[model samples]
Target chain A: MKDKIRIASGSGFWGDLQSIPLQQVTKGQIDYLMMDFLAEVTMSIMQKQKKRNPAAGYAKDLIQIMKDILPHIAEKNIKVITNGGGANPMGCVEEIVKCAHKQGIKGLKIGVVTGDDILDSIDNLLKHGAGLDNMESGQKVTDVKERLISANVYFGARPIVEALKKGAQIIITGRTTDTSLTYAPMIHEFKWSWDDWDKLAAGVIAGHILECGGQSSGGNFLGDWRSVPDLAHIGFPIAEAYPNGEFVVTKHENTGGMVSVDTVSEQLMYEIGDPTNYITPECVADFTTINLEQQGKDRVRVFGIKGKPATDLYKVSMAYNDGYTAIGSLTYSWPDALEKAKKADEILRTRLSDLGLKFDEIRTEFLGVNACHGPLASEQNEINEVVLRVGVRSANHHDIEAFGKEIAPLILTGPPSVTGFAGGRPKANEVIAYWPALMPKKLVHPKVEIITT
Target chain B: MSKIKLIDIAHGRSGDKGDAANVGIVAYDDKGYEIIKKHLTTERVKKHFEGICFGKVERFEMPNICALNFLLHNTLGGGGTVSLKHDAQGKTLAAALLKMEIEI
Candidate 1:
């Protein structure tokens, strides 16, 4: 069994920096490069793309990243794992195969882990007594069944580990938990058993820390932002995993970001609800039980993570077409900018109300002032500029489109010194609402397929 | 005791889970954690974010890491793709919440 393995993080989400994977492959020694490209709403977007063009559902950036790093990857024998496959893992794998062939690299075994995309099976499952009720609102699937864009079960690290066992050099998945990509390498390399909750939990925490790429390694750090060095060439995070459910969060040598106790701790707490029961498809990790200590420069040792047995149900991420939303912004300058912005908002709303256009939700924000903090923002006495931003959400796209038209008119009719109307007209965008649900584990099984080029 | 920002003693980061936004504040030291524990109540947090978060604010204690996580419900407008606000996901909510003053 391997005593230690280094897994480097590449991409955080779908649109993250593409060069990150290449840097990790060429600049450092890593057993696996895990790129997380899927987000909560990414599946729905990918589904829409697939409907428009069957060959274009998966993350296209993955192919480019593979092409850039395939040469080094083949030379170093570094395995690549990612959920960049999005809605179509098979399509993503085929693209990778073509990339390998173009690069003159032969006999590349790429594994595609699928069966997570259940958009087509939602009706069959509903017939089989799978209610798939919204976990948050307790609403039935029938409430938005007609509008569902995508529905996928969150798969765990098991299938990826199985792919590794089968000698697959590159693994692509659909709707797999972001953490699974990082932990699957550890589980396979160290020969960690399925029931090893503590080790698996440690791996899960590592994955969490690495999932966001540079976020845990100093990029976008809220603490002492100025103190974090060389963010221009920020080094992505790497986990030096050991067999005893312990790892050190570090970065590549000569790299930019700092990997201290604070950074790792903050990441451990990001987007987490109920620290005692951080649930994944494979295990329930207790975030509160994690222990961190700075071992050396840019190295924080993480250990003593506790976890419970795997849950019987897998969390389902479903997105449906809720409505249309349009946002319009106009900047007001100098001599009481806050007042001018407020006046503009009032006038715009009055016009919308006067036109007999009803909206499900109409919201406004003073960009330079309370755009972020809202009521928590301090009262502004005088401001140089404040962007008057208004957005409306409604079922009728025509109403939203009309609302978009009203913003440019406000510059001449209502608010004075209005500028920054660079974008001509605010376009109506389709709103993809998220639906969280749970499905029985036995009902869905992950399918892994390996292709060689 | 003088009024001081939460950032004076602690630092935090916030992100969204659907419509809910969670801000995890970690103290610079054990003393700072104690100060936050006594002063940073869920009621206080909810009140501090009066118009921003229209729902309940639940705080969870993490004594081991000397951190407190506040989950603000029904915030973020509508979250992710649905929300029209500039800070739809509440990514900057932590920095904003840190502006809250406490008697130290």
Candidate 2:
């Protein structure tokens, strides 16, 4: 009531249960419904969609949800912000407008923020000396350029904020930071000036805390997870941020899950590279100034979040063609199944050598033993059937394809009790590389166009 | 020479307490689990966690879980928008603890 606003994240990922968003809108008194759709793989899948159909890139489920929640959203004046724009925001808006028209909503405004995905600009950018260095390896972008799959700049809340300033009802963006959806509502509602670093950072911090949905509200908590209440009905946290940079973390009254000072603090400490300099395009949030305390049973008071002027540069996420990779598998029955799998792996390697094809890397893992553990897996007994997965990555697509063909031949030639091969021939898929770089913030000027039905 | 077991720092998580770094250490059992205390001494821990850390390390023990919290300094790799591009593997201020290799 006192210059406060509520922002809630309904879905953490695509295919999340729809009832959460419905409950947030209907029961949580949420001012905004923010949905996150893009994962690392999500962009690739969306790219495939855009390749097949011009108007199909955004999250497909949004259209269905819009139809169901049309009456409630329109009646409550609740705005929705999502990065559901897989590869295209314009196409997403067009569909939303169509859905609105069918629902007989007269004044629904749709806004699209594009230009974050610049796969076509890679060559030009490289020519201009944007090395797009790998953060881990310090390698040049060219190392993975030809094999790139998806590249997207992580836009912050500026575009979404601009959309709100334009009075756009629903904002769709491509590859905006996960926290920006919640932060946009706070900035739009409070009219947070761009220079209000402390307030902005507070909002960003709040957004970051709750961005992963129930993770901040005790759902995915590693702390005493078993007693974390009904995880199936876990409540997502809402950040009620104010102009003074103080916010309260809370959830719906009867919702399942916990939101205490500790939960919020734990989430705040997650994925943080630096605390004092939580850098963002909009503002430089100082995580040190953050003060969290338990205000009530299901509420945490977040305060003292300080911030500074944001740097001129914005982080760019450009995916490039890194290399060609092929995965071939075989099943070896027990009583030397592991040995059989190992033999198949050696056979494939020898075949690749005979073909004189070299790859950057090759790895073989016995799935029943330890895939996640890798080298750390303890020695276990041979299983009934061992699944041998052989993976190779290289610049040679033909060689990779050839490696795929070697697996099926193993049944006739190499190993015994070889079954469990179901898939078709292996193919060369584009390798979407990750290029993390900082560009001047001035480069990205957001355009919010409201398509009224 | 004593070998520290995996039960020592199994549940450790770090945070800041004013200017100092406080590492919360929980031993595996309810008692003073020798593996954790053997390696997590203030002097030895300080040696195992140098260069990677910019601040002092304060230690504490917890019940119910074997965990420790160590706070480091200016970890966000100079926090701000600039640090977002840097991948510190979520170590940030606790770089020293990580560099010293505390395994589960």
Predicted model with the maximum TM-score: 1
Residue lDDT tens for model 1, A1-453: 877999999999988987889999878789999999988999999999988998989999888899999999899999999999999889888888988998899998898999998888998887776669999879888999998999999999999999999999999999999999999999899988889998899999999999999999998887888999998888999999999989999989888989998888889888999999999987999998988999999999998899999989999999999889998999999988888888888888888999999899998888888889877777768778988888899999999989988989887898688898888999999999999999888888999988999
Please tell me the TM-score of chain A for candidate 2. 0.87
Give the lowest summed-lDDT range of ten residues in model 2 chain A.
Answer: A370-379
Tens digit of per-residue lDDT, candidate 2, span A1-453: 248778888777777767777788888587888888875456766876898998887898877877777778899988888988778888887888888888889888777888787677767666665456765346666666777667677788888888887888788888898878888887777777888888888888888887778867886454455667887787888878777778898999888889965466556655454456777778888766766667879988888777899887766665544456777777899788888888888887898899888877776778777543333345577578878887676777777787777778888988788987788766665454445666555545555666776
> Which runs in model 1 stand beyond 4 Å of their true positions?
none
State candidate 1's DockQ: 0.82
Q: How many residue pairs clash (N, CA or C atoms closer than 3 angstroms) in each of the candidate models, in the order given?
A: 0, 30
Q: For model 1, which pairs clash? A: none
Question: What DockQ results do all the predictions give, each relative to the true complex?
Answer: 0.82, 0.07
What lDDT is reached at residue A236 by model 2?
82
Q: Name the best candidate (by lDDT).
A: 1
Q: Where's the lowest-lDDT run of ten residues in candidate 1 chain B?
A: B95-104
